[model samples]
Target chain A: MKKLVQDDIRTGVFICDCGSNIAGYLEMKELVEFAKTLPNVVFVQENLYTCSEGGINEIKLAIPRENLNRVVVASCTPRTHEPLFMSACEEGGLNPYLFEMANIRDQCSWVHMREREAGTQRAKVQIAMAVAKAAKLRELNRIQLSLSHRALVIGGGVAGMSAALALANMGYEVDLVEKRDRLGGILNELNMILPSNEPPDKLVNNLAARLHDNPKVTIHTGAVVTKTEGYVGNYVATIRQNENENKIKCGAVIVAIGAQPLKPEGLYNYDGKKVITHIELESKLKQGDVQAKNISIIQCVGSRSKERTYCSRICCMTAVKNAILFKEASPDTKITIFYRDMQMYGVENEQLFRKSKRLGVRYVTYDPDRPPRFDGESVSVHHLRMGRDIIVPTDLLVLSTPLVAQDDASEISTMLKVPINENGFFLEGHVKLKPLDFATDGVYLCGNARFPSTIREAISQGLGVASRAAGVLSKEALFTSGIVADINPETCCGCLGCVAVCPYGAINFIENRGICQVNKVLCKGCGGCAATCPSGSARLDGFSNQQIYAQIEQAMAV
Target chain B: MSDSQFEPKIVGFLCNWCAYAGADLAGVSRLQYPPNMRTIRTLCSATVGPHQILKAFQKGADGVFVGG
Candidate 1:
C-alpha cells in the first residue's frame, strides 16, 4: 500500500442542474450550493448539460487555476457518464480513475417522483456515500501479466468447431474439448441449416476435419473441464477427456456450452412418441403429410422465468420456419402458432412474418398470465382481443420451448470464478462494450451458454471470443487495472474474508504467516475486498478507501 | 418553455434483449423518444448491474422506467 500523502488535495464538485432534469423537482441550486460547503471542495459549479464540452472545459479550467487533484460529478447513471467525467478530470490534469461519479438521476429522482423532499433527501445521502467512496480513490497503474498464446474451447459443436478453426487459422493453438463422444452436439440433432437448406452435419464435419488435420489444434472428445482455475492470460484448467484426466495451461477459455431443448414434464404427458418437440416435428414434416388434419405449435411453453424467463431468442424464428413447413406440405391441415409475441425482428423476418400470414399459417397471441392449455387431443387458448377462448383440435402438439443454459453452469462458474445471471446464463463484462468478456479475465462465454442464441449468433459469439482471445494472446505483455486486491500484512488478522468475496479466487491466506496475498493475475480490483474487510486491511490498488475518503473530505471542505 | 412542460420523461432500463436493442433500432431508424426518453443498457432485464435505476431517480427525472 502507498503511504497516505497529505498534499492539500483540492477537489472540484460539479452539481449539475441538467436543465431542471435535476432542478425541477429537487432544488439543484440548493444542491450546488450545498456542494460548495463540503470539505476540500475548492470549486463548486452547476451546468445545464455537464456532458457538454463546455462543462467539461469548466472542469479542465478549474484544475489549473485551483490545483484540484480530485473531482466529483452529481449527475445521471455513472454507467452512461462516468467515463465522460473521468476524461474531463484527466483533461483537467487529475487522474481519471481518481474521479468518483455520484449517480443522482436514476437512483433518486426518477423512482421517487411521488415524494420530492424524500427523493432529494435520499439523493443527498447517496451523493454523500459516493463522495465517501470516491474520497479514497487512488492513482492506479495497469497490472501486466505474461500470457500463453493458446485457446481452450469447450463443447465440440458447430460453435466450438468454428471457433477452433477460426483461432487455428489465425495461427493460435486450439484445444477443442467436447463432452459428447461425437463432435456435434445439437448439430447431430439437425438435418440442415435454415434458409440455405444445407446439411449442418456436413458443415460441422468439414470444420472438425480441419481441426483434426491441423497440428496447432488438439481435439478432445468426450471431455469436460472438471476444475477450472486462474484469471486472464494464464489459467490452469483440468479436464477429464475420454476417461483420462489432465490439466492444460492456456491463456484463454471459451465457454460455448450450447443449449439443451426444454422438454416439459407432464405437459401433454409428452412421451416423446405422442407429444414431441420441434426436432421430432421436423422429422415428421420431412416424411410428408400426416393423416391428421390439425397440428398446433405452442410457443413459450417452458420459457420467459419461474416457468422459464428468457425470450429463447430463436424460438419465434424456429416456430415461423416450422409453421412455413406445415403450410407447404398439407394445405388442408391447420397449423396455428399460439404465441405471446412473434419476435420476427429483422427485415427478412418481417418478410417471413408476412409470408406466413399469406400462407394461411395462423399466428395467435395468447396472454402470458392465462396461457394456452392442452387437453391431450386439443389445445384451449383464451384470446384477449376477441374476448373468447377458442379450442383447436390437433393430431400433433409441438411445444417450441427455448434452448436453456446447461445444468452445469453454476459448477462451471464456480470453477472459473465468473457470475451467472439470474436466468443462470453467464454474465458479460458490459452488455454493450465487452459483450463476450466475463468480469473475470481470460474466461470468455459464447453460444447458448451466454444466452439462448440461434446457431448463427452462437457461431458469431464463438468467433468473436476467438478474435478477442487472439488479441490478448498476440500481446507480448498483458496489462490490466492494477486496481486488484492487495493485502496489508501488518493488519492481517489471518481470517479469510477476502477469499470468499473474491469472485475470481484471487485472494488467499498463505500458510504459517496466516496473511492474505493477492494473486495479481486473478484480482479484478472491484474493491469487494474492502467492503468485506473487518480490520480495514484489504484494499484495491487505485480505488483505495483512504484516497476516496480524502477526496470526499476535500470536496466537502470546499 | 415547452421543455419544462409536463411531458412524461421516460427513463428506460432496457435489457439487451428485445427491449434495449429495440430502443437502438428505434434510434437507428430515428425513432424519436419525445426527446425526453433516455436509456441505460443492462446485461438483461434480470440484473440491472449497479444501482443505476436509483441514480436515475435521484437525478430528478420525472419517472424512471424499465423495458425488456
Candidate 2:
C-alpha cells in the first residue's frame, strides 16, 4: 500500500543531437549513456533530430518497448518541441501532459557555445528541476465547462459596437456595456472617417441600431464594470449603471475598449489654439478654422521609440488624411507632413499617399532623434533627406499622436484573468493567426485595447472576436484542455501559498483535506502555482521534476 | 497591517482599467518593488474604488499611484 509509485512511473529519456544546433556544443552519446543510471529510466536513446518524425517514431517505439509512462526530451524550449514529444507519448498510450521538455538548445548551447561545460552543467540543473516536477505528474483528465450562451462586451467604441453586432447577428445573446451616456464611442464625434470618405456617425448609428433590434443584444449605457470575478466558462461581472453596480454572469467576455487620444499638454506649446492635437485639428477642420496659408502636421508624437516604442500605425494615415482634407479645403495651403517613416501598407493607403502628394501636400523627412522645433508661427526642421536645417512658415501645427487603450485596461485584464503586452495592450496569442485571442482560453480582446487601430481595423477586430466567442459558447459542454493540474494532497501543508499566487483564481484552499484544490476548468497550466508551492505539495501531471532531471542528467553526462 | 508607520500602507488603485495587470506582470516577472503598497482593484480608471486611494493617503500612505 505504501509503494513508491516508482514501479508505476516508468520514464524514457531521449537526448537530441538537434541537427548541428545542439550537437555542436553538447555530447549526446555520453548523455544517452547516463540515462540508464537514473532510477526510473527504463530506456535511453539518442536522436539526430528528436523533433524529426523519425525521432518521434523512435519515441513511440520505445514507449511500449520500455513500458514508459513518462518522457523527457532534452533538446529545445517547449515552446517549439514540447508538442512533438507529447504527441509521441500520446501515440504510445500515455497521457500527453505527463511529459516535460528541457531547453538545451536556445537557452543553453546557443547562449553558451564557448562554455560548453558550463552550458551542460546548467542544462543538468534545469533538467533536474523539470524531472522533480514531472515525477509526481498524475494522469490528467479532460475539463468540460458548462457554459452559458451569452457574451458580454465592455466598451461602446467602434470595436465594441462591431463586436456586439457580430455576435448578435450570429444569434448569440450579447450584453454591450458602455461607460458614456451615449453609444458610438469616439466615432460619434467624428465628422468623416479617413480613406473611406464616409460619415462615421452614420456607421456608428447603423451598428448601434442593428444591435438594438437584434433581440439578442442587450445594450447597457452609462455602465462600467466595477468588479470582475471568475474565469472562462463562467464569469461574474458587476457593472455599474445608474449609479449602481449590476451583477451579471456570462460564459465569455470581450474587451473592445478603444484607446483615447494622447493629449498635447506640455509638449511644445499647446495653447489648444495654435499648437493643437490631430483630434483637435479634426474638430478644427469641421468647425471651419480661420484661414492659415501654411499647415505643418507632425507625425509620431508620443509613439514609436523611447517614449511609446510601439508604432501607433494609424497616425501616418491620419496625417495624410488631414493633409488631403486641408488641400481640398484650401488648395493654396502649404500642407507639410513631418514623418520618420511612413507606413502606408495597403494598396488603397498607398494610393491615398500619392493622391495627397499630387494634390500639393508636401512630405518632409525628420529624424526621431532630432524633432522639428516649433517656434510660435514658424517651424525649424532638420531635413535629413535634404541635409540641411530648413525653416518652413506654418499657420497651424498639428501633432498626430497615438490613440491609447482605455485607462481601465489593467482592471479589465485582472477581472478577465488575461495577459496584456508590455505596452499595456491585451496580448493576443499570435500576432497574426489568433489576433483577437488572449492566452487565457475563453477570453478575447480586440481593437485599440490591443494596439492603436483605425475605425476600419476596429470594426474588423470586433467581428473577428465575436466569431471566436461564438465558437466556444455555441457548444453546450465546451471542451477545455485535457491537461489539468494535478496535486498530491498528502504532501500539502495548507499554507494556501499557491492559492494566493494564482492569477486565474483556479487554486482554492479546501477545508477537508487542508490543501489547495485546483479548479481544472479555470487552470491555464501556466505553472505559477507549482512554481510557488514551497512544500512541494502540488505537482503538475506529467511534469514531475524527476523525469526532467533524468533527461537533463543524461544529456549533460553524454 | 497598517498599524505601524514603518508598514508602508501604499494603497494603490490599480484601475481594472490599466495598472492592475501592470502590477501583475511586475509580480510575474519577479520585479522587485517596495512592499509598502497594498493594491485595491477597481474597474475603470474613472471609477475610484470607494475613495480608497484617498483613504490610504489619509491612513498615512506616503505615496499613491493609480494604474489605468
Candidate 3:
C-alpha cells in the first residue's frame, strides 16, 4: 500500500440530491462549486442519490480518477449511510476510516425546507466542514482478537440448563456452574409446573438427566465463580467448588441466576405455619396436606409499594395457578384471592385465571393504601366493587410476594463488568432490539435474573440467550472498532481523570509508568475520556482534536 | 448586534445516539427550523469540550448548542 502525506491529501466530495429531498430545497449547483474551494478538495460531484448503486459507482470511479485519499459524502445522516460510503471507499482501495459525512438531507435541506437561500448557504458550510475534517482524517486499522469456542454458564436453574443444552447441541463445549449442591433452582421448591400440570421435580429431573447425559456439557454443582476477567471472545473465570478452584476459559458467559421470592416475614402477619407464602403453599399442595376449607390468598404483599415500586410480573399468574389447583383437588374448599389487580397476562395465564373463576374461586380487588387486615384468626378486606368492607374467615393465608434479585447479583455484575437496573435485575443491551444481551459483549442475561419471567418465557429466553452466545462463539475472531481512545505516553499525567470518566472501564492507570492506557477492546468510543483529560493526553482516534478543530474553523468561515 | 438586524451564527454539537437521530427524524418528518446553526456530530455530548464552544464564539458564532 502506498502512503500519502498531508500535502498529497486529495478529498472527493459527493453531494447527494436524495431524489430532490436535498436538491429541491438547497441550491446543489452552488454547493458543489463551494466544495471545490475548500482546502484539499480536489474533486466535487452531485448525484441524484449518493446512497444508490449508480451514485456509489460514481464515487468508486472518482477515487482512482481523482487520486482521492479521503472521501466526503454530503447526503443523509452518517448514522445510516456512513457505512455504505465507507465500504465504497474500501472497495476503491482507499482506507475506509478516511471518510467523513455531511448530513444535508436530514439536518440541512429537510429541516430548512422553506428557507431556500439560507438552506443552500447552510449546505455549503456543512460541505466545507466535512471537507475540512476529511483532510485531517487518518487511516485507522481494526484490532482483531482470537476467540475461545467454549462457553461458561453461571447458575444451574431451568434457564441455565436450557441454555447449556442448546449450546451443547450446537457443538460447543459448555461448563455449567451452580452455587447450590443440586440443580433445578427454584423448580425444586415448586409443587407443580403449570400448563403441563406435572410436578416441578419431573421437569427438573428430565432437564437434569438430559444435561448429565450430554457429552459436551460439564456440570459443576456446589460451585461459585470467584473471579471473572477479560472481555468478549475470551474470558478467564475462576470457579470455586468446596476446597478446589478451577479456572475455566470460555468465549461467552450466560447469567441465569434466577431470583428468589420475597419472604414477606413481618408483613401480612407471615408466621410460617398459618400465614405462609406461595412457595410454602407449593410444598403443602405437593404433600396434599390442605386441612383448611376456607383459604384466602393476598397478592402483592412486598412489591409495588413505596419501597419496591416494580410490579412482579409473574406473581399474579402463580396465585391464579395455585388457586386453580387447590379448587380442583378440593371442590368444596372456598378460596378467595384479594388482589390489587389480577395481572393474568398471556393466553395460558388468562385461561387459567378464567378456569379458577369457573371452579368457584372468588376474586376481590383491594386498594394498596387500605391493605387487608389479618388478625390472628380471620382476614378483613375493603372491597372496591361492593362499596363496603367484606370479612372473609380464612384458615390458610397465602401471601403472593414478588421475586427479588439474587443476593449475589451485584457481586456478579461487578465481576462480569455488567450492569443491573435499579430493581437489581440485570440490564440488557437494549430493551427491545437486544433483549438477551448485556451492553458488555460476550455476557448474556435470561430468566428471573433479567426480570420476573414465566417458565415459558424463561425457557425461550434461555434458548434465545444461547443463540446470542453462539453469535460470538461461532465467530473466528472479534474485531474492535478503530475509533477507540488512545492516551499519549509522552504527555504523561498520572491523574486518574480519564479512568474516573470512562464508563466502559477501558482506561487503566499503569502504576509504575504514571499514565493511563486504554484497553482498546473494552472501549466503546464514547470519547468521554478524551474530553475529560485535563492534560490533553487522551484522544479518540476518529474524532481527534485536530479534525474537530478543522471542522470548527471551516464552520465559522460561512 | 441589534436584535432586529441580527442573524445568529450558531454551532451545534449533537451526540450521535439521541440528539442527532432526533434531528434526522425532524427532517424525515419535514419539520422546518431555521438554518442558522451548523452541526458537528460527536460520539457523545462529552466529546464536545469547552474549547470547541469557545472557539466557535471566537470565530464569530453568536450561540453554541450542545445536545446529547
Name the top TM-score candidate. Answer: 3
Decreasing TM-score order of the candidates = 3, 2, 1
- The digit string of per-residue lDDT tens for model 3 on A374-487 reads 996788988888879999999889999999999999999999888998989999999998999998789999999999988888899999999999999999888887899899
**Per-residue accuracy of model 2 over A322-415 as CA lDDT, tens digit each:** 7887788779889888898998989999999999999998889899789999989888999997898999898788898888766788877876
- Candidate 3, superposed: residue stretches over 4 Å from native: A1-7, A19-24, A53-57, A486-518, A526-539, B17-33, B44-54, B63-68
Error of 1 at A240 (Å): 1.0
- The digit string of per-residue lDDT tens for model 1 on A313-337 reads 7878888877776676677779888
Q: Regarding lDDT, does 2 or 3 come out ahead?
A: 3
Query: TM-scores for chain B, in order?
Result: 0.65, 0.70, 0.92
Model 2 alpha-carbon drift over 4 Å, by segment: A1-79, A97-138, A169-171, A266-269, A273-275, A287-296, A300-311, A334-343, A363-397, A410-435, A467-558, B1-68
Worst 10 residues of 3 chain A by lDDT: A1-10
Give the clash total for candidate 3. 0
Residue pairs clashing in model 3 are: none
Alpha-carbon lDDT, every model: 0.72, 0.73, 0.90
**Model 2: number of backbone collisions:** 32
